[model samples]
Target chain A: MRNKEKTYNEIVQTAYVMFSEKGFDQTSLSSIASEIGISKPAIYYYFKSKDELIKYLFDKIVQEIQSLTSVELETITTTNFKQNLYQLGEAAISHQEKDVHFNHLFNQYMLLASRDTYYSERLLKIQQDFLNTFYDLLTYAVKINAIKDENILIKSQLLALVFDNITNFILTDMKLDYKKIWIEAVDSVLSGVEHHEQ
Target chain B: MRNKEKTYNEIVQTAYVMFSEKGFDQTSLSSIASEIGISKPAIYYYFKSKDELIKYLFDKIVQEIQSLTSVELETITTTNFKQNLYQLGEAAISHQEKDVHFNHLFNQYMLLASRDTYYSERLLKIQQDFLNTFYDLLTYAVKINAIKDENILIKSQLLALVFDNITNFILTDMKLDYKKIWIEAVDSVLSGVEHHEQ
Candidate 1:
């Protein structure tokens, strides 16, 4: 059982790198096994196929991300709401930066989500969770009079889109100051932009 | 020459629906050929393989979109810049609504672009073109004294992110009023948001 667990981790880690670099269709079970110095049967003992391997990776990543950044509802106050929310987005970006080739994994997942109903549903759940988090914060902001006149529901959804899309700049290899872009948009939307009619 | 052109269009149109519905990997050349009521060899006569067919489809779609929406810079001004820019975004959304299964097709392309240097480079050119359009309009806004901003380039890039992310809500089947969302963000950023500090 112990050895089997080690082998499982190896296969999944290898699949993550391969799938990130090569995509799902092009990456084969044989290549994964070869990279890990194991036979195809060894990978099969844990994951039945490439689809199964990817599914496992997806579920595990989701779980890890959720647990790592789960927030307590009772803890958020008006004063800290913006900071807390910003922290959450930062945590997500940092996790991607530190560990898994998260941007590539996410780009790969977008392809899968478009075709596979399973992935589509899985992604929706994660997005809904994030949207709700933004909604709750925006609701709190409205309560304290931080932002006004905006439909919180639509605003939340839009903010979620804005936040989620920040990571996409990485894929193009463009020399983008992503931090500035991310901060400017998120801050202005949440705290309300200081604007004037000239 | 005419028959060859007809055959090429037939293969591309058929591939479009299959690739959107079934994804690039699952949509085999045999499947596309059979669906088009043509033999496998006929598909090869126009294209080499599934990869070549997809590349051709991608290039064709990019060219079609570019030609369909090429903008004239001479007409934009301070007063009409916001509306003109808003119109550009609407054109993109409506084009997706009318012709291409754009959300699905774009999702598929993201996956392909992540791994394939060729597709990645191709997409960058398209994106750069779009980015330049946004930058140009924003620069015009600044010159005409419409938008007051510290960094036009970064603001333009961030605005592009905000606008581009709007289409993403479609993929989840969420009943979002995307046009409203798109316009609100663009307008606020372009025409300074009406702000009152308490």
Candidate 2:
């Protein structure tokens, strides 16, 4: 049983890499099985179909991101909201770097989900959860006077978009140092030009 | 000659709709031709291949956006910098709305360009022009004290990302009132948060 579970994870990881490198349409179940040194039948036994494999992988990644957000939010002890928000942004960037497949999978999944109803609901739920977590954090920060209180939904959506763009920019264009640009951008958001009055 | 130009334009427009609706991979030259009431051979006459057709459409869209930005920037008076910047954002959002296929084409083109050197260069140049245009505008706005003076590159990139996200959000999931949200967001950036004075 343990061996079967390990093989299942290994197959998913291999699929992630192949999908990132070749995109969803170009990557195939047969290619994944070949890369994993397993037979087509073995992959079928584990994932049933390519769509199923993609859906499962998408769910797993979303779950992992949610867990990370939850952990970070729960551990905040400092009253400095800028530092806290910076930490969240850094965590997101680090996670994307570690999982190179995250951005590709996200783009692919979103593109596919837009056309197909099967994936849309699942994707929407994941998106809503992400938005809600950020909204809650922003709300908390505002309550504590850590960050300015404003349109929580709009600001949350904007923040999410900023991170998404940063990730997509890095993945699509390899010329720029995305990490440096992202850090600088986040700092600008945290500290505006207005001098704080004592 | 005029008739031929009209037919060619119709073919490209039809192809854009079909490609955005069904995706580039699933769309075919024959489908576009049929949608435009033209023969496959006729489409071949205008665009040697499906790839060429796609490239032409992508370039056309990029050029249109660039021209719009140029026209808007040229009309901006230094005295009304905030209003000018807001108008620019509005123009971008309106342009994006008018070209529903822009996001679809951009996403498809990016994916294809990632694999092809020729298309990749064209795509990069178009993207760079868009970023540079906004960077210049932000720099001007800072010089006029219309907005906060900060890192032009970083601020411009963040603004670009915000606009991209707004477009994506409108295109993908949300059906909210974009005009209101966009105006408010732009205003917030222009007026900025009233910082606690030291």
Candidate 3:
């Protein structure tokens, strides 16, 4: 990485940690800068303000999620669609488990987004894109007679919502066998559709 | 109300507004007292600290939920089980809708619980209680041949989690017709069970 890019990443990384630990309202740019042993002015070069820094972090999070699921989401054969969904759940959990605090941070950012119109719109757009992906996949499943055509819109929304809630379950109860639980949960939702056909 | 009870209620009510508006971390007892036109010492006389006050608030929130769902939860006939669940979701949403900020405040409290062991246990117990209620209903459904007896535990857990997530969807997107969405979501999950039995 170039020197500027490296400095920019350092600032973002430090801010992410501080925001999660102390919370968005309590963590200031100066505190983040001091934590990195840098002057406030240096961070200002990379991020004009704390809000800008947070927006950048949100984009980075979106990019991480996209990269994680892009391969499975793009390759949607009828035979492998259920497997892809299961893999998506597994990938999300394994990635979050590796990071440990990512889900908590993501939720914290969500609360911030919920309060701010600009951030809310940004977050909602990404969520809608995801919902659209699931909707299209379900539409295809219906085409193949994999699922009944009933309530396709709501089922897709429910699946997307469940994906988020499963991540939240990990946050609330670390003892939960979330990967196993998530796979089973997805299986039931998908296979339940197959049962519906009969 | 009695004089002491009235004062206590005032303190709690003021704190709830301030906490939702400014967040838990940013809201102070002194500020709450000031907002209520009470002296700091008077506030201390009722609650020892902000932490104690927060615990009191948590209890109040739990009681509110219990009151809202107690009747539906207690009278769960096999025939009315799904109907009861639908009613519970409706009751929850309508109550939160009445308060406007209640869902946001609840989510804020959840974040606090996620970080603290004491609060996490308190929150988890209530979640477990709700899950058990749903689990029993599903087991009864299985016994009656209303549904298949597969994955009862996870289904109950998923149902409880979806309840939380549906409220969250309202938080993130107020434009959502959450009451309709929630009822339909529950119906599919329950009706999908019947499909499984077929």
Question: Global lDDT of each model?
Answer: 0.73, 0.70, 0.73
Give one digit per residue, the lDDT tens place, for model 3 in A1-198. Answer: 498888888888888787776678778888988888888999988778878888888788878766664543346766777777778778777787788567667777777775677777877877777777778878887887666787777777777777777777776674566666666656655654663424
TM-scores, each model vs. reference: 0.89, 0.83, 0.83
CA error at residue A124 for candidate 2, angstroms: 2.3
Q: Residues A27-146, candidate 1, lDDT per residue (tens digit)?
A: 888998899999988887887776778888888778865685467756776567667767766776666567647667766676677668898888878777777877877776667655
DockQ of the candidate models in sequence: 0.54, 0.38, 0.44
Q: By descending lDDT, how would the candidates be arranged?
A: 3, 1, 2
Ranking by TM-score: 1, 3, 2
Q: What fraction of the true interface does each of the listed models get right, in terms of native contacts kept?
A: 0.51, 0.30, 0.40
> How far does residue A60 in candidate 3 sit from its true spot (Å)?
2.2
Going through the candidates in the order shown, the clash numbers are 0, 5, 0
TM-score, candidate number 1? 0.89
Q: In terms of DockQ, which candidate is strongest?
A: 1
The 10-residue segment of model 1 chain A with minimum total lDDT is A188-197
Tens digits of per-residue lDDT, candidate 2, A1-198, equal 998998899898899888866787778788888888887889988877888888888887777767866634554543555566667767777777777667776777777776888778877777777767767877766665566665666666656667667767766574655555556544544443223657
lDDT of 1 by residue, B1-198 (tens): 898898889888998889888888888888889998898889888877778888877887788757744667678776676778778778767766675466677667866777678888888888888778778777766666667756778778877887777666665666678888777667545444322236
The pairs that clash in candidate 1 are none
Q: After superposition, how far is residue A80 of candidate 3 from its true place, in Å?
A: 1.7
Task: Please tell me how candidate 1 rates in CAPRI terms.
Answer: medium
